[model samples]
Structure formats: structure tokens, C-alpha cells
Target chain A: MSVTAAFPSRARAWLRGLLAGPLALLTALLTMMGGALWLPEGAAGLDHLVVPVVFFPMLWAGWFLYACLDPRLLRGFAVVGGAALLQLGLILVHLMAAKGAVT
Target chain B: MIKLPKQQTQSLLAVHGWSGVLLGLLLYAVICTGVAAVFAKEISDWSSPLSRPSGQELPTGFDAAYRDLARQVDPLFLHEVFLFPTAGGRWNVLFHVDEKDAKGQPVERGTEFELDPKTLKPLARRDGLLDEIADQRRSNAVADFLVDLHVRLHLPNPWGLLLTGTLGLMMMVAAVSGLFLHRHLFKEIFTLRRRGGLLTARDVHVVAGAWNLPFAFLLAFTGSFFSFATTIGVPAMAMVAFNGDIEAATAALTAKKLPEDPSPVTPANLDALFADARQRGGARVGFVSLEHWGRADARATVQLEAREGGLLNTAYLYSLASGEFIREQPFLGHVPSTGNSLVLLMSPLHFGNFAGVVSKSVWFALGFAGAYVTLTGMLLWTRRRQEQRSWRIMDRAVHLVGYGLPLALAVAPYAYFLLRDRGPHPADTQGVLFLAVAATLIVCAAVADDLTRYRRRLLAATGVALAGLPLARLASGGIGWSAAWQQGLASLLAVELALFVAGALYLRLALRRSATDEATPAAGPAMQA
Candidate 1:
């Protein structure tokens, strides 16, 4: 491989690693925090809180593994970033509703 | 085995190695202490035993003793009360009220009575804030030291919990990526090459890692859940649901609800309620908590030990005013559900206390192996890069922590025994001693010429320290072996004997390592990668 060709490849690899490492972690955290709001409470009314807390590790692990194994870096970013944004939106919506109710 | 694309497999291999290399030392520390802490209850009993076993955690006259103590406690702090067995089979009765401190932080100011279960007489009394009173408990100092190290590495508040939780996640990542990287998993499980250097070491690492992969994953998942659930999950949920009111969030999850009826009314006979709970649950009661005692809405909750071969225990609720039995409920919620069941399962799966001593022994061995794999994995990584100056520094660190942590842990109990009766704050003294030993080890690691020699010497010191523990205990007014035997304190004697045997084994290994001339570099040039 020529040096010129390898430079671009190396840069791309660095970018992919960043996305898969820290960005993936942020995505998992956002999803967990927001997913709790949308998840349905079971008959006992505690599932929404208890289930997410108990399975947070698996949630993060799945996202982390997926971020690493995905062949296309762009797709990984799109999927992870999209999920994060969706959850963030849900959280904002809930906060807005709560504020309105308080007012 | 599952097959993956070549590129994907390589990616996972990098993930596995980097994850292990990054947090491997801290994870090893956690696992090592955790293995010892699996028998923390036994350690407490062995270190500080009553004249007799007390035979039961909560004795028959507990109700009377509790009532007497309740009469003496100030009514201002009687909003809640708890009765549980503490170290050395002593029953602790705590009456407290949650009040905001000067900084507006919620804290429990309470009175605690340590009563001898056999005699139903108060052995000690403490009145202060809950945290301050907790610091004065010296009987369980040794076990608490080990558990605190394992759970949080002695870091304060959420930081220690956060670090251990992150280590748990790192272990999970390593386990998952390892599963993917090893294509011939079953074939490697039985393979151990007889080569004398890195080949043999790599083989051992692979075999042990392969065999422990599932258990490692299970423990990591459950352990992280326990750490994060308190530090992050509850508060985050509270923020979203209760506008950051933790108390309200806890009440919702715990299913605590009562109509406001604080009218003065004497509570009914707690003895009858205790017997009813035991009869209904078909298990021994482990803990009892009464809310709003001596009030019209007083409620008592009794937690029971799980029955033989059962995974879950029943918690009975009673109306203390009428002495009527309420419905039995699960630990977390008012009714049995999947979420409650999963949360309940996490304790036994992580602690391995589901089946008593047998299960605990298995967990201890497996946890020890997990710790071994972590140490060797780091050593292999560092040894492969030992030529680089930075990597050489890391190599020294790996050796220091790998051998020095066990030495520090072995030294802590000595401090506990020596300072327990002589001081008011033995736990603090023990902590300081632990840090001093660790610092000394680090300095020794820096000065030593041969890393291998340093490891051996440290191991031998640990062995000597462990062997001397029982003598120290006996010298410090503990029960002698003959007395322990006559009193049927078999568990205490067994722990003493086990520590002696373990010490002897470590000494033997260290001596054998000293006799060997194969102190060659950990990994050969070809293995460097």
C-alpha cells in the first residue's frame, strides 16, 4: 500500500474508532435515560423503573458491540446518533409536559 | 462456535485486548476482594463469636428486648425502627427519624442498641447520626474492610461506585469480545501446552478465560446492575418521574402507602406477628422493620431467608395495630412480576449465596479464577511491549498491584485485631494501615532489581501474614481452638484452618518459584507481536 493511500485509510479508521468508543457510550446512556419514560409500566407499576435499571449493562453492551462490529462506519453513526437523538427528543417532550402541568 | 467475518473478528479481538488492558488492574482488585468477601458473614462470625452460636439470628425474646429498648428511645426518633442481626450474632435495634441537616441534606439521627441475642441484654448503646454510629462498629471491621474495597475501592460516595461499575462494564466487554474471538472455543477449553514460557501461560489464560466466560459475563452484568442501580438509575429515574425527589421515587418503587393516621395507639404483641410470619413463610425471619410504630397506622415488614432449594423468599406485612397478617409480597413490589423476579435473581447470581456454603464455595473459586485471568492478561499485554519505556513502567505497575493487593488485604485483619479494643475508631486505623502497606509495596516495586523476585517476596509475606492471623486473634482475647471446638464453633475453626492452609500453599509456591532458574522474560521475542 502506498503512503498516500494509507494516510486516508488511517484517518478513516481513527474517526470510526472515536464513533465506536465514546460516542457509542453516550448513545447508550441517552437511550437508557429516555427509554424509561416511554416503556410501559407493568401490572405492578414498577417495571418501567426496575427493568431499565436492572438491564442497563446489557443495553450498553449491545450498543457497544453493535457499534464495533458494524461494517459501514457511516451506518453505525447514523443508527447510533439517530437513536440518541430520538431518545433526547422524548425526554424533552416529557419535561415540557411536566412544566406545563406545573404551570 | 459462531463464525464471523475476518475483519469483524479482528475488531472484536482488539476490543477484548484493549478493554482488559485498560481496566484490568482495578477489575482484578475488585474480583480478588470479592472472592474473599463471598464468605464475609463467615469471616465476621469467626473473628468475633459469642460464647455460643446463638443458634438463631433472631432469638425468641427479641420482641421483649425490642419493646424495652423502644420504651427508652426518644419518641422524636421513633418514626421508624429496624431490628437485624449484626456481627457476632448480636441483635441491633435501631430507632431513627429522617431529618434534614444544616445543609438541607437528608440524614438519619438515631439511637442504636447492640443486644446480646443469647442474654437479651444490651451490650452497647450509641446515640448519634447514623453514619457516625456506623463508623463505631468494630466487631465487623475486617469483613467491612474487604467488602468496601470490593464494592467501591474505598472511594467516597458515588465516585467509588462509579469506578467499580465501569470496571464491571469493562469485564463484560472483554468477555463478550473474547467469546467472539475464540473460534474454536471447545477445542481451546481442554488444550494446555506443556511449553515452559509464554506458550504455556497463554494456554492457561485461554483455558481459564474460556471456562469462566459465561460466569464472568453473568457476574459483570449483575454486579454492574447493583452498582449503577443506586448511583445512576434511581436518581435519574427520580429526576424524570418525581422531579428529583428521591424519597418519593423510593416510596413509589417500594410500594409504601399508608393513610395519614398518627393517632396514638399501642402496638399489638410483636411476638405473635413474628410467629405468624415464620409459619406462613416457612423460613426463618432475617430482618424486621416497623414504620410509624406506636401509631394507628403502624406497619411491620418481616423479611425471611429463602427456603432450601428456593431462589426467592417471602416478605410478610402485618398491621401492627390489630396484629393481623397482611398479604405476602415480593421484595421490590406489591406483587410478583417479571421485573421483580429479575431484580431478585441478581443477588444470588452475583453473590452466589443462593445455596448456602456449597454455592458460596463454588463462587469463591470461580471469582479467584476470574481474578487470575485478569492479572495474567495484563501481564501478557505488558510483557509483549516490555521493550518500550512507557510499557516498562506499566509492567512494574501490573506486578506491584497484582501481588501487592493481596498482601495489603492480608495485613488489614492484623491491624483490625490490634487496634480494635485499644481505640474508638479501629476501622479508620485499619484503612490507614491498608494504604500504608500499599505505598510501601509500590516503593519496593520501584526499587527491586528483579520483578520476579519482588513478586515472590510479596507472596511469601502475604502467606506469613495470613498464617499469623489466628494467633493474633487468640492473643487478643478471642476464643481458643479448644474452646471453639467444645462450643461447636465449627465454622469459626474451619475458617481458621482454611486461612492456615492457604498461607502454607502460598509459601510453598513462593519457595518453589525461588528455586527455579527459569526466571526468563515473561514472553519471548516471537510472542511479542
Candidate 2:
């Protein structure tokens, strides 16, 4: 490994660590909140609320483990960030619809 | 063995070691306190026993007592009423109304009464905000102290809950990574080297960690769910779905609704309802809640204990006006669902109270092993880095918390017994004493020449404190062993005997360690590395 090549690799490693630690945490939290909006309510009409609340820990743990173990750093970032964005969009749409209904 | 790529295995190993190294001490504290807290109910009863053990938590005349308490509470605060059993077989009743505070935040103000279950006589009364009343309870001071330390480490509010929840997440990471890192799981479960050093210690940590991985994962998942559910989940859901109206979100989630019928109506026979609930559920009634108590829209919910050999309890709803059994209801919603079942499983899995003493004993042993894994992992990690100054400081801290925390916890019951009658706020006094002892131990840990001496002294102190707790209880108006036996207080007697035996065991261990230290000079502080 040449010095010039090693520098970029080290920088990428640092970026991966940052993404796996804090960004992963933020993504999990957003996903949980967004899941409450987007998830289907089961026959009892409580899956939307109860499922997210009960399995929040599992959701976070899964994300954390995946974030740390992914071999490609950019792919990990794209997946986590894209999931977070999707959830955020769902939540925003729901809130907008609710506000429109009220108005 | 489950095979994995080398690089992925190394990644998991780093995650495992770093997670344990970073949060290991706090996790150990939480697990150690949690082991004691698994028997929190029995501890409460043992520490603060009534004159005689009541046959049932709620006796026959509880209806009359409820009516009497109802008359004393303000009519404006009659929206909801709670009746439950507290420590020492005391019945606690709270009448409250939820209203917005000055800052548009929800708060509950109520009048609470603690009654002796045997006679239904009022033992203590408080009228104030619900949180204040909760802070003033003293009967279960010792158990509450242990539980609070486990739950939040006595830190305040959402921050404490968040910190503990993070610790739970870290524990989950450690357990999961440990499972993958140890490719020889089955083999390691039976592997223990007799050579006493880092290798032996490493083997023990791996074996215990591997054996406890599934349980640790379950505990971590459930514990974090509990910590975050109220602190973050509900509020965040409310923010998204209900426009931040927590009360509305709660009502919608519970699926309970009653039309506003303010006509004053006498409640139907509560004793009959209790009897029917007990017969139907085949369990003791643990809690009773009535909403709109004096109105035509009144509804009463009776929560029963877990039936024998069952993990979940059943709740029944009744019309307070007609005294008719409405239906059986799940805990979270109007009907049972997968979500409700999962939520129900969390409590038993985390607390290990599903099968009474047998389950609790199993939980205690497993939790102790979890604590051991945490402490040993930290000791091993720091021992490897003994050359680094920061790691050396951390080594001392590991010893301070590992040995010192148990001593402080053992001494708290003493403070509880000694100050119960002599002080105005025994709980607060107990907290101060707990901190004082911890501070003293920290100083001792720093001043002592080596880890061995510090550990020995702390263990000896813990042994003395634990052994003398029963005498302190006896001196502070508690019943003696003879009276306990005569009255069939077997649980209380067992607890006292267990404490004495544990104390003796700890003292013996400390003495043996001290003798070994004297015989082998090389085994003193050098062994820590």
C-alpha cells in the first residue's frame, strides 16, 4: 500500500466510523418515529402504535449492527440515510394531511 | 459453529470490546442492583412486615374503606381513582384529576391514603401532586432505592432514563457481537482453564458471556423498551400523530370511551366485582381503577396477578353502575393482539416475576453472571492496557465501582432500618447514607496500596453490614425469628437467613483472599496486571 493510497483509505475509515456511530443513531430514532406513521395497524388497530413502541430497541440494534458490519462505507451510508429520508418523508406527509384536514 | 469472514469477525470483536470497555462499569452497577431488585417485593415485605401477614392483599371490607376514602377526597378530583397494594400488605388508594399546569403541561393532583390491609385502617395520608406523594412513600424505601438505582442510577428525569437505555443498547451490542466473535460457542461453554491468570479470567468471561448471551439480549431489549417507551416513544408518537396531545394519544391507544353522563349514581358492589374477577382470572386482584366514579358513565377495571404457571395476567372491565362484568381486556388496548402479547411479554422477561420465587431465583443467578461478565471484561481490558496511565486510572475505577457498589448497597438497608422511626424522611436519609458510603469507599479504593487490599476491606465491610441488618431490623421494631416462625412468616425468615449466610460467605472469602495474599507476596498488586 502506497502512502497516497493509504491516506484516502484512512479518511474513509474515519468517515465510516462517524457514520456508524452518531448518524446511525439518528437514523434509528427517525425510523422509529416514522414507522409509527407508516406501519400498518393490525386487526387490533394497535400495531401502528404498539409495534413501534415494543420493538424500538430491536430496530435500533439491527440498524447499529448493520452499520458497523457493512463492508462498503458508501453503501452503508446510502442505505441508512435513504431509509431515514424515506421515513422522514412519510412522517411529513402524514402531518401535512392531518393539518389539512383540520384546516 | 457459525462461520464468518475474518474481517467481519474482527469488526464485531472491536464493537464488542469497545462497547464493554466504555459502558461496562455502569452496566455492572445496573445488573448488580437488578439482581437484588428481582426480589424487590420480598425485600419490601421482609424489611417492613406488618403485625400479621394478611391472607389477601385486598380483604372483604375494602369496599367500605374505599367509600370512606371517597368521602374525604375532593369531588372535583374524582375523575379517576386507583387502588393497589403497596409494601407490607398496605392498600394504597389515589383519587386524582389530570389537568394542565400553568405551562400547558399535563399534571395530576391527588389525595393518597395508605391503609393497613388487615384492618383497613388508614396508616398514612398525603394530599398533593402525584409526584410529590410518590416521593414521600417510605414503607418500601429500601426496595425502591435498589430499583431506582437499577432503573436510572438515581439521575433525574428523561436524562437518567436515556442514559440507562443507552447502556441497555450497549449491552445488546456486546451480547450480539460476543455471540459472533466466539465462533466456538458450544466448546467454550465447557472450557475453563485451571491456570489462574489472564487466560483463566478470559476463559471465564467468554464462557459466562456466551452462556448469558441470549438472556442478556432479552434483558437488554426489554429493559431499553421499558426505559424508552414512556420517556421517548409515547411523546414522539404523540408529537407526530396527535399534535403533541399526550392525553389524547393515550386515550386513542387505549380505545376506551364513555359518554359524559354526570348524573350522580351510587357505584355498584365493588366486593362482588372483586370476587367475580378473582374467580374468573384465577388470580388475586392486583390493582383496581375506576373512572368517573360517581357518574352514570363509571367504568371499573380490575387487574389481576399472573395466574399460577402463567406469564401474563388478565384484566376485566365492569360497569360500576350495574356491577356487570363487561369483558376481559388486554393490557394495552380494548382487545388482544400480537402487539399486546409482545408488550405483555416484556415485563415477565425483564423482571422474571412470572413464576414467583423459582423464576426470581433463576433471574438473580443469571443477572449475577451478567454482572460478573461486565466487571471481568473491564478488568481484562484495562489489564491489557496497564502500561497506559489513563487505563491504569480506569483500572482503579473498575475496582472502586465493582467492590464499592456492593458495600454501599448492603449498607443502605441499615440506614433504612435505623432511620425509619427516628427521621422525618427516611428515604432521603437512606440516599445520603448511600452516597456517603460510596464516597468513603472511593477514597478507600484510592488510598489502599493495591486492588487486593481494597477488595478485601470492602468485602469485609459489606459482610459486616449485611450480617448486622437483621439485628438492626429487630431493634427497629421488627419481629424476631421466633415470632416470625410462630406466625408462619416463612418468606421473611428465609430472607433473614439468606442475608446471614451471604454475609458469612463473603467474610470467609475475604479472609481466604487475605491469607493467600500474605502467603504469596508476588500475588499482591502484581496479579492485577
Candidate 3:
């Protein structure tokens, strides 16, 4: 195969690898962190924190499988990246609000 | 079976095989060690037992020892105290204060005392950071070595944990993919061909893999939880929730809140509390934690083993001053909730210690099957591509690790038994010897003309090492079999006999393989696989 013909396929493969590996991990972690903010704090006021940590493996696995199995690479990127950004934004907002209240 | 399109099936197969090929060796090591680690307590008892059997019941005079140690240590170190049993039912009392180190990381600076459960006499004492003190331990070195290898492959913290956790993820991928890849998973579970060829090799691997899928998934998920809960999860969660204070985050999740009254109040007798906990829990106390000792706000939490047939542990909270039972404690939080229940389930599920020896035995066998599937899968993968020189070399590397690891592990106990007393720390000595044997095996594998001979030699060596371990123990002051039988040291006898039998079986198989090799060199690839 010519270089130009091979380039797109190789690039797509590398992108898929990145999405399935590191990007998926980042999304899982961010989701876990954000869970403490959104998840209900049960009677003990720790359900949100404890539950997310406990279910971390499942969350990571889910994201990883979706990343690997999804045919539309752009959709995979959008869903994972969008969820990660959403959580990151929520975390920053929570921190900022807490800081404002403190100030 | 769950049906999927051809393209997806191919993707799943690729993921399954490549994941095994990439991380299978380390995963196999983890699973192999984990099989032995199921009997860690038995191994500890077998390696180092007291003259008399120390039952689960906490020995008397424990309070007196605690009081003596309390008076001896600085009051600052009395912020918290932990009491648990260690090798051979010895009481390990650690009085420590949690403090930040120079780098602002949490460290427990403590004085540890190991006491004889029978006499309550201090066998050893060390003062330092908790990790450092643990490094100096000897009595349970062999068990600790195996558990450490299973958990982290003996690498340094964070890195070792991360690597193992990643391996757990890989295992999760492999299990999930294998499940999706197999169209006849149900049939394969019961289908094993006796025909001696590649077909039988594939059948064995598939059968074992199919039967072991759920267990593999369970182990992988729980193992990953344990590995990452502290390393990544706790730290990241702490960063968000507790301003990077892991201790504070841990306290919020696990610790019970009691009103502060710092005025000195005499603590209640530990023996009475232990007995009460035993009666209430219907099991022996496995761990005890004392917070704000000798103060009005002091609390003692007694964690007991799972009740007669239960899967979850029982923990009871007590007021240290009055010695009155406060409540039946959940693992996390004060009351039982979804989170606490899930967290409580993790330990028994992962360790398989809830049902005692029977459960542990089942878990060990399943883990062994998992290891077998992993090894056979890799061998078959290599065998299929053996026409290439690189694949042939991969075959040798696989054999070296697959057989050499067991050989090294079988030989490790020799160092522990020999140097356990009147020598350098047995844990360190075991590491050195394990590495030495592994190095030697690597060289042997490199120089060997035939892979079959090298594999058989390793098997024979492993057999000899295992068979001789009991002798080494007996020679190095271990109790005799007669004494063990008389004293009802069933665990010791069982472990020793198991080792000997396993060793003898390996020797027999090696000899048989040698005969087969002589009769027809490379007659059956199934045998090699």
C-alpha cells in the first residue's frame, strides 16, 4: 500500500488506541470524582464518596468497552470527552462556589 | 450464547488474545501466587507455630500487656492503638499517632509490640514508622512474601500497585472479551477431548476458561478495587473532597463520630471487652482499633470474623470508658447503607476467607484453573506460530517464566526456614534467593538446546524444592509430625502434606515427560502445551 493510503488507517488506529486507553481512563476518573458532587449523600453523609470509589472498576470498564466497541470514532470521542468535560466543569464550579462561600 | 456480528467477534477475539499475550505472564504470576495466598494464614501457622495451638480465642492478660506498653511509650503515641493477631496467633499491638511527614504525607509513627498469645510476654518490639516496622518483621515472612507478591509482585509502592491494578484491568478485559468470543461457552464448559493433539489443548484451555469466566471476572474487579482504592481512588477522591487529606477522607468514610471530651478517663479492661465482643459477634475478634485511648471520647471498635456461615464480617463499637457495646458497626459509616454493604462485600469476595478452609480451597482450585487457562492460552498462541524464529523464542521465554516462577516460589521457603532465626531478615533473604533461582533458570533456559528438557528440569527442581521444604522446616526447629498430630495442629499437617504431595506429583510428571520425550521427541504438541 502507498504511504498516503496507509496514513489514514494508521492514524485512525492510533486515535482509537488513545481513546480506548488513556482517554477512557481519564473519563472514568473524572466521573468518579464528579460523582461525589452529584450522587446523593445517604444517611451517613458519605454515600456519594464511598460509592464512587467502590464502583471505580466498573465505571472504567464500561468506558473502556464503549471506547473499543463503538464504530463511530467521533461519537466515541464526543461521548467520553463530553462526559469528562462536563464532570470537570462541575468540579470546578463546586470548588469555586465553595471558595466564594468561604470568602 | 450471546450472538454478535462477525466483525465484532473478530475484534473481541483480537482483544482477548492480545491482552493475554501482553499481560498474561504477570497475570499468571499474580493468579498463581494468589492460589497459594488463599492459604496464607495456614502457611504462616505451618511455617511458625507456637509449642501449643493458640486457638482463635484471645489469650488472657492482654490488657495487662497493653497497659504496660502504654506506660512505656510516650503519651503522644497513644492517640490510636491497633491490636490484631499475626503469625501463629501472636498478638500484634501497635500504639501510634498519625502524623504528617516532612513531605506533608500522612505517616503513622508508632511503637509495635509482638506478644505471645499464651504468656502475653513481649517477643519483640520496634519503634518507627509503621511501614518500616513491618519491614523488620520475621515470624510471618513466608506468608507475607507470598501475599506481597500476589498483591504487588514485590515492587515498590504506588508503582507496584498501579502495575498490578492495570493488570487487573487487563484481566477484566480478557475475561469480558473471552465471554463474548466464545459461541459455545456452555457446551465447552463440559466438553473435554482426550485425544492427544492441538485439538485437546484448545479444548482444555477453552473448557477451563469457560468454567472460570465468572470467577475471573469477580477476581479481576475486586482485585482492581483493592489495588486502586487506596492508590488512585482514595487520592483522587481526597483531592476533590477533602483537600488532599487522605486521612481525613478515610476518617469521614470509615470512622464513627463521638463527642469530644478530652478529660482523662480510665480505659476498661481489654480482656473483658474481647470476651464480650466474642460472645456478641459469635466469632473471634479479628482486629481491634482504639481511638483517643484513655479519654472520655475514646472508642474501641472490634472487628470480628464472619459469623458461622455469613459472608460479611461483624464489627461492634464500644465505649472505651464503660466497656459498653455502643452498636453493631457497618464497615463504612455508622449505620448500614448501600455503600457500606458493597464495601463490606469486597473483602470476603476477593479473599474468599468467609467460609473458612472450604471456601478457600474452592477459591484456590478456581485460581489454579485460571492460571492453567492463562498458561495454555499463551502456549497455544506460541505453538501456532512456531514456524517463525521469533515465535520459537517466545515459546522458550514462556516456558522459562511459566515453569521457573513455580520453581522459584517453591525454593523461596528454603531461605525462610533456614535464615528465619539467627540471620538477616527472612523476607529479604527469601527475595534474594527467589531472584537468584529465577536468574539461574533464565540462564538455563537461554543455554538449553531443547525446550522440552528445560521445562522438565524446572518441573523436577520444583518438585524437589517442594518435597524438601517440610524437611527444612523440621530441621530448623519446626515441630515434628507426631507432635503436630497430638496437638491437633491440623493446618500445619495439611499444608506440609499438601506440599509434599504436590512436589511428588510434579516429580512423577517430569519423569513421565522425560520418558515420553525419549520415546518420541515432540510426538504430541498437546503434552508440551
Question: What are the runs in model 3 whose C-alpha is more than 4 Å off?
Answer: A1-7, B100-105, B196-199, B514-529
How many clashes in each candidate? 0, 0, 0
Tens-digit lDDT track of model 3 for B1-529: 8899887787788788888988989998999999999999999988999878889557777888789889988798889998888888888888999799999987889899988888888889999999899887888999999999999999999888888888988899999999988887897788866544334667768888999999999999999999999999888988888878887998888778778899999999989998999988789889999988889989899999899799999999999999999998888888878888888899889889989999999999999999888888888788788777787777777888888999999999899888887668888899999999999998988887777777788889999999999999999989999999998889899998999999999898788863544332232242222
What TM-score would chain A of each candidate receive against the reference chain A? Answer: 0.84, 0.81, 0.91
Kindly report the interface RMSD of candidate 1, rounded to 1 decimal. Answer: 1.3
DockQ of each two-chain model: 0.69, 0.71, 0.66
Worst 10 residues of 3 chain B by lDDT: B520-529
Query: Residue pairs in steric clash, candidate 2?
Result: none
lDDT of 2: 0.85
Which residue window of length 10 is worst by lDDT in model 1 chain B?
B520-529
Give each candidate's interface RMSD in Å: 1.3, 1.3, 1.1
lDDT: worst 10-residue window of model 2 chain B = B520-529
Provide TM-scores for the models. Answer: 0.95, 0.95, 0.95
Could you tell me the C-alpha RMSD of candidate 1 in Å?
A: 2.9
Interface RMSD for candidate 3 relative to the native interface: 1.1
Question: Among these predicted structures, which one has the highest lDDT?
Answer: 3
